[model samples]
Target: MSLTTDLAQAKSRANIRAKARAKSGSETTPAGEASPSPRSRRRKHRERIYQWLFLVPAVIYMALFFGYPVVKNIVMSFQDYTTATFFTGEAPWVGLANYAKVLSSSLFSTSLVNTALFTLGSIAGQFVIGLALAIFFQRKFPLNGILRSLLLLPWLLPLIVSSAVWRWILDKDSGALNRFLGGLHIVDTGIPWLTSTSLALIAVVGVNIWIGIPFNLTILYGGLQEIPDELYEAGSLDGATGWKAFRHITWPMLRPVVSVVLVLGVVYTLKVLDIILGLTNGGPANSTQTIATQSYDLSFHEFKFGEGAALGNVLVVISLVFAVLYLRASRRSVDE
Candidate 1:
């Protein structure tokens, strides 16, 4: 009799549990509706809208500042827009005429070759000397931090100021550099640093190298600091200390940074205008004239806006190509 009573109570409890579960389910979610309450949905939607609103200003700024200029330049490249265009409000489309005019000019080849040489020489000198300086600074020394900070003065100063300072130093007559060389009897006379057609480009490239060294040194030094000391320790165990360890470990580790630095150096060197304009003004028979200087001369000096835009577009294309190289290097760096 007692066992029968216990079974009856158990059945009743089971029925109660079923009804409770049904009640709870009905309260929690109605049929076929998985979403939360309307208030919560509205809150989430508001949050999403706020997130988008935060990004709107940045998007708008980029469109106005960066996007508009590039588009305008491209349009100008295809149109015959000059100083008169502002008054007349007419810029007739000329298709590829502007491109042809600039490309067919005699100075195009010279500018292109000068651009190549300038980029190569500046990047090579900056990277090598910067790397050497970075390595040297990695060692324990008195006033190392102060000296490294001071090396950044050239890069921190305005390009015009740096160029002007260099111009004084490189002056043919009575310049400090000439005075030093004469005192040492190195040249026996004041060398024309920025005057000679043969030497102006070289002088400009050297100044650029000086300007770029601090950048390279700072980046490479940071990259070197990221390298693990344990790797060097293990490498030393295998008789890989000085050059061999650097060749095997450091080079492999630093290649990505080197790639980034070189690509950036090339891009920056290619677009260099201020230094050249300030220092040489593409003078001495246009020997120092690069694509950038040429473009500036055409636009501002000669009022050939269309031709200048075309040359500027060429530079943009070259930069875009190098940008691809940079992206590849960055991706490879991340992968490795």
Candidate 2:
């Protein structure tokens, strides 16, 4: 009985010692509460510095290139400054006169119409041809990779070079296209492809479509490849075939990619200048003039800086509108 009572007393004493140690360990120290470890503090400081350092170059470039020019152009559009006046430091404020002139001009209307037609035609043609080619190439075939690479040749070539080649092929007397067509009795004589207004516009659009096809094809093919084969198999097991399969399975899967391509294609086609410049120079009567070409002619050729700025501003507005439309459409599609 005496031994058991001694053992219980010893156990109680051990528990008290352990509780005292745990309490002391839990107590916070002054130094520990005052500051965090050097490593963690240094890491946080380094992250902030790196964040600003990474953004610095981009901010500087935008201020110099995009911000300054936009401000200067806006200022210039309100001033009536000629070549002489530009150097004389005597530009008169013209308010809305430059804008009024541009809006009232026949050239502006014609160029707007031409630009619209070109943009729409090129987008339609490219989408059709590219989608067709992508569908055709989705299957396993011989020399498929080789053919795909060869198809990109036109797109890879410099725009000026492509324009020059097209010009030669469309030449009245000595062009290869004319010769070939004549041999086939397609035409009675060599037609003036570049000299005719309607034909010139059509030819420029056709060349743009041809050049754009490869890029669109590549993108569409990638999208097609991403679609699971299981979806098609399931579609086939149903009563779906041909167009029904594409409409229900392929199109829904490709909607996002198609939206992106359409937006980009519209923007690119609207801003096309090099091809038209090299091919026709907005001739044979200014029939192929687009906003980009018109801007060039106004600023450099006619020395109307204010008018050119207005035209550029208009183009910017158009692009923004399209971008907004695209975003809304994409959002609605996703919601659906």
Q: What TM-scores do the predictions have?
A: 0.85, 0.81
* Tens-digit lDDT track of model 1 for 199-238: 9889999999999999999999999999999999999999
Q: Name the best candidate (by TM-score).
A: 1
Candidate 2 regions exceeding 4 Å error are 1-53, 84-90, 329-336
Q: Candidate 2 at 127: error in angstroms?
A: 1.0
Q: Candidate 1 at residue 136, lDDT?
A: 93
By lDDT, who's the top model here?
1
lDDT score for candidate 1 against the true structure: 0.90
- Cα lDDT of model 2 by residue, 118-160, tens digit: 9999999999999999999998999999998899999899999
lDDT (CA) per prediction: 0.90, 0.86
Off by over 4 Å in 1: 1-54
Candidate 1 scores a C-alpha RMSD against the true structure in Å of 15.3
